[model samples]
Target: MEPSSATVAAYSPCGSTAAVCRAVAEGTGLAWDERDLARGTRPEPVDPGTLVVLGAPVAGGAVPALGLERLGRVHTAFSPCVLVCAYGDRDPGHGLHDLEAIAPGLGLVPVAAVLAPVRHVMVPALGAGRPTADDLAAYRSFGAAVASALRDAGGLFDLAPPPLPPASCPRERLELGFTAECDPAACVGCGACAGACPAGCIPADEPYLTDTARCDGCMACIGVCPVRARSLSDPARLAAVRERCVAGWEGPHRPRLVMGA
Candidate 1:
């Protein structure tokens, strides 16, 4: 049967995953709707034969819990959905597993998966910036491949489920430290940090403070500040941030599908 309307949704704190999904949908000549879960938006209902594609950035080695909860609510209605988890250079092991664990409960079947890379702000010295020309090309290729897979498969592909045999690797923890030291003396109460933070962890007001619990450690605010006042204590903090951000990630991995659950 010809598919019903398609929805391209994402819960990206940094907009990387959403960009990739939108590009893929456009390239495939698919008319899709976007639902940003980060803004408290829910996925719209899909008609019979409709395809649903969901994407999210792998933060702290997992799809944020909020995204999973929303997916669960609409799982029964959407079957054969594709899950894309965007990451930096690290493996996406635990993040993919997290996606799988949340999907089954919602009754959505996993079809194709991809561990695409996007430029992250963790370590500026480590080539963190907008996706390079090569990066964009690679992501475009991956997107096209996924579009083809969906068209060819007609439904969710049967694959092994995730959380495969926990590894002995020690997970890293995000170091909640500022890059550009915010000087209280020279500080202008612009609240730019609060506006720039992707995770919305920074508060808007004088002596702008960050909620470490809510911070994803993306360092976006540091990059956006005009005063160059926010910065990490040293290179050590940068390394710690990188390690912690990719803690549970296995590195460039994808999930297996568990069928007939």
Candidate 2:
């Protein structure tokens, strides 16, 4: 059955995944209902006839558990849905695969999956200024293709799930354990970083300090710091990721799209 509208949900702290998800939604040629999980809002119930687009940034060689947890809040029954995972140049990992694995249990019928490449939060130089004009255009095209597939299918079950992207980088090598460190002196007491943190590790009372144990190291706090006070606490881990970025993801990489059959 053809969908009436689309709901786009993404847990993007640094904004890359959100940007990509928006572009894809625009390409679907449907009115969009947006849910930015960064705001700590619960996902609304998905209409059975509404197409759903869910996405998250890859962290620690996979999609962060928080992202998956937020997705679980969405209730749907046989709704056609698209899954996406944005990763730094290192590896796509099992993010897309894992999302697909949970789709059935969530009452979602997986229709397509996208593995997008974006600027690395930890190593900005890697995939820097990425998801360029060309990449976004490609993503839009992928979305249109998904729309076309839905239009032609008889029902959600008639369309086959998109093929999963193959994992490249070894999981062991992708674990760069570094939490954001805020410089107390440079902090101006603005709570932008605290609000931007998807992991909710930043306390509102003391925005400058992050709970490292719960921090996903998504770089959201660092990105939102107006004074540029936040930084990765582990220099050694930073260096290691930088080295890997240069060796593995130096040049431009196109997003991988698997359109539903």
Candidate 3:
């Protein structure tokens, strides 16, 4: 069941997950297109024969609600698909499990699942300098393997869902109250943060002001600020989160790839 082509869809606020998606697409040896869900654009309908690569960054212990919502809109018909979750050195928790559980409803069959380590948007110190050159290479290798499996399958019906990793973090970690704040002096009134905000919480008129109520704490605004003006509002809170992350996952971690039997 070789696919005609491949499409990579992702909701990466800080682009780490998107980078992994691209690497995997490159491995498939098929023509690939991308749909950035972070920008709030709707992805076009995918043909049944097209291979789909879907991914989102892990926020807390699971995928962000908005990422899941946008991905749910992409209806398919049992199309062969690969699932990916990019995490910030902390426990990937049930992110992959959650994505796999919903794959069927999205008209997708999970042929493979990947958990890639990337810098945490909220706490950069946790998984700093990640999705390194080695990480991308591994994603490409995994993609190639996925392509091989599809090429060997008799048809879509023969494809089986891969076994995903068990849940690691507790559900309590799902809601970490974090918000991006901007420094007035360093902020040059650039609209980059507002434009890059997936939640659209940052106002254009007052770019430095983040509507905390609406912000999902993705930290895209902090990443996009040219002057590095934006950051998590509370240093003590961030430190505590970082401490927990370090205590749980201190050593360097690599991407985890699971393929179908």
Which residue pairs come into collision in candidate 3? none
Q: After best superposition, candidate 2 residue 129: deviation in angstroms?
A: 1.1
Scored against the true structure, residue 41 in model 2 reaches a CA lDDT of 61
Residue-level lDDT of model 3, residues 75-113, one tens digit each, is: 778688899998887778888887887788888888999
lDDT of each: 0.55, 0.82, 0.85
TM-score pick, better of 1 and 3 = 3
Candidate 3 wrongly placed segments (more than 4 Å): 171-173
lDDT over C-alpha atoms for residue 28 of model 1: 45
Tell me each candidate's TM-score. Answer: 0.66, 0.93, 0.94
lDDT of 3: 0.85
- Backbone clashes in each candidate structure, one number apiece? 17, 1, 0
Collision pairs in model 2: 1-155
Ranking by TM-score: 3, 2, 1
Best by TM-score: 3
Q: What ranges in model 2 sit over 4 Å off? A: 169-174
Cα deviation in Å at residue 192, candidate 3? 0.4
